[model samples]
Target: MHRPLPTFRVNGAAIRTIRMSAGLSTSETAERAGISRRYLNHLENGYRDRMRPGRYAALRTALGLNPDDQRLLARLPHEEPD
Candidate 1:
């Protein structure tokens, strides 16, 4: 069954939590995710809400998110775009 993509949300806190749990620093995660450190920092600090779809996919891959984790993230409340 094809699952519809969940409503887009800004779960920066969740991302930061997961990153910390994985023992990766912002720089490390950014490098691994093929994104800039500044961008990662913005996400972690909740300065930014939405990232490009490609970047979001890269982040999920970089974070090594399991299926359940992915679901949890999907369900997080959406943030208003700035």
Candidate 2:
């Protein structure tokens, strides 16, 4: 059987804050991150508590997250350590 992707529980508020500060709309951010806007909204609104690591990294990169911002994300709990 195919294994399920691991997920990381992230801070939705922090992600939303960074995205807004970067002046990116959900649609734009999602596009940049190669994900759906609805999924991004779900993440930002905490409707979804966790995301796959690749998606998380893509979101971070799309938001242009800095070291400090990365630190903020480092507090996340993951299914597996990186």
TM-score of each: 0.71, 0.75
What stretches of model 1 exceed 4 Å from their correct place?
A: 1-7, 71-82
Model 2: ten consecutive residues of lowest lDDT? 71-80
Writing each residue's lDDT as its tens digit, candidate 2 over 1-82 gives 9998888777788888888888999999999999999998888788986888788888888988743455325263553368
- Candidate 1 clash pair list: none
The candidate maximizing TM-score is 2
- Model 1 / residue 71 / CA error / Å: 6.0
Residue 61 miss distance in model 1 (angstroms) = 0.9
Q: Candidate 1, after superposition: displacement of residue 63 in Å? A: 0.8
lDDT of 1 by residue, 1-82 (tens): 9986544454788899888888999999999999999998888787887776668877877888853455214343354344
Query: In the order shown, what is each candidate's alpha-carbon RMSD?
Result: 7.0, 5.1
- At residue 32, what lDDT does model 1 achieve? 94
